[model samples]
Target: MKLIKLDAIDSTNDFLKGLSVTQELENFTVVSAENQTKGRGQMGAVWNTEASKNLIMSVFVKDFVLNPNGIYQLNIATALAIIQVLKTFNIKDLSIKWPNDIMSANFKLGGILIENTFKSGGRISSVIGIGLNVNQTNFDNLPKASSMAVVADTVFDKEKILVLIVERLKANLALINTNSQGLWNEYLSILFKKGVPMPFKVKEKSFMGIITSVSAAGKLVVSLEDNSFVEFEVKEVQMLY
Candidate 1:
């Protein structure tokens, strides 16, 4: 595992994308930045962060066997890795939101963005980027955002945090290679709002349901008040805030 640290970059994922084509990048190569100028999130959203206040890094993995049904496991594995690391910091009330947002009591603590490059046959590479709020104290514009400092009541050293995350990610990646189902089950155990009643929006209609389980294919299974279950793809439904 080689780490490339930079003072700033447009986006760690973007930087890796550019390099993926020209270079023979190895698996577990990390690209980290002190600041990201144009960070990206799921569905083309911008990932906003204060410079040096968060852990912004990307990991490159190549030669993964792509099971169309198991693609979502990558997100679960990455999210679990982050949560495992945060646990060592003794942060309580931390959990993962579906598809990959780290939350603490409804306030977002971090997020994971996975971008894959495919060749003719299988996955050529995957860039797993993570953004975690660590020391930032204020969240004026972002209402549901929070930092570890707020929850822990103290500051954290960035370098140490990065090291722990890398180690956890490595361990999780190994688990992915061996016991993906176990990893998925463990991920569901820490899911936010799991087994709780909540409102979700689908096709502009709001319905009250309980999150029962997340399918291996990444579809969210929700049980409605009528006891019927519906599975939702990523864009098919939105979790009500």
Candidate 2:
């Protein structure tokens, strides 16, 4: 549970990744910063947060999942942990949008970016970066963005939320270390728009599809209007909603 606090950084993920390479890092070593200049979201999307108003952090964990195929479990565990912690604040309509965006009542609350390093002999180390809007309410340019303060109408202590998230993450991650079957089911249960027809874009083309299960490899599975199923990588598809 070693935690590093920084006033600012280019990217917490990059910092933790470099730290792991240079020296020994404890399991679940966490690095948090008040601001990030080059923060990144899924698929290189820019992650921006007001200084000291959000959670900008990255966690380093090694050998969490035994096999490369099971690595998606890390994403599931991390997302579920955040969802559970936010629920305590009574945030409404909470759901996990596929690939890593956290949603609340159709608005974006946070996101996740996971980077995995595969070592020799089938070992894997992952750097998980999470960005959550805590007390920040200014989203003038970003239409879909909202924060805990705006949504709940109550300012929250960011440290309170961070502590609970870390605590829940450890517990949730430990479950997958044994068997992840139930974890996948729980992830889908609250998955945003699961089984509902929704619009998506692939290669600049748009179509309607029902969100189905997620592949073991972490690809989004969709059932198209033709009743045919297809798997899409993170870069290949875009959710219109």
Candidate 3:
């Protein structure tokens, strides 16, 4: 569980990738930076953040034989780990969006990105990156973004927050190893749009459905307006805005 803290980096995930190639860092090694110059999200979207105002960290783990279906469990565990840490601040209304975003009400609070390295045979390592908006007070340019300060109605100490997050993450990882189904159940309990009708778009067709469940493979299942159920991969459906 070696932790490396930096003042700035291009991207924590990228830093960890480079580090893994050069040296054999221990499993659970963490690389964190105060700011990321070229942060990235799923599908190469830029992860926007104000310098020194959020948490930008990546966790490196090795030698886990992660089944493709269990990938969703990993993401759920990571999001729950961060939520557990934020709970210490008594932050309420925290919830997880399917596949990987954390939110409160309608505002974005954080997100997780899990990248895997595979040899010809199987998976070799996983790099889990997290970005959480913490002390920033202004989001004038980013309407969907909100910070811990804004939601919690107070300021927070970044170092203490990081420490708690690491501890919680360790706990979540242990649970994942021991009882993944249990962890997945807990994740489903907090899933956003679980049982309510919501507008959804698939293949550019707008329709209404109630989110029924998320499969172990991270596919979302929806009960359509006609009471028929369908499963779609993450890219197949979008929550209509």
Question: When superposed on Cα atoms, how far off is each prediction in RMSD?
Answer: 1.4, 1.0, 1.6
Query: lDDT tens digits, residues 27-104, model 1?
Result: 888899989999988877889889988899998887653665566777887898889888888889878888789998
- Tens digits of per-residue lDDT for model 3 on 1-241? 6889999999999999999999887878998898899998876878988888888999997665356556666688788998788877987788888778888877889888889887666666789999999998888978988989999899888878877877877788787767887888888888887898889987879999998898767888899878899998866788964
Highest lDDT: give the candidate number.
2
Considering TM-score, which of the candidate structures 1 and 2 is the better prediction for this target?
2
TM-score versus the correct structure, for each prediction: 0.95, 0.97, 0.94
Q: Which stretches of candidate 2 lie over 4 Å from their true place?
A: none
lDDT values for all models: 0.85, 0.91, 0.84
Candidate 3's TM-score = 0.94
Residue 41 deviation, candidate 1, in Å? 1.2
TM-score ranking, high to low: 2, 1, 3
RMSD of 2: 1.0
1 or 2: which has the higher lDDT? 2
Clashes of 1: 0
| By lDDT: ranked, best first | 2, 1, 3
Model with the higher TM-score, candidate 2 or 3: 2
Number of clashing residue pairs, candidate 2: 0
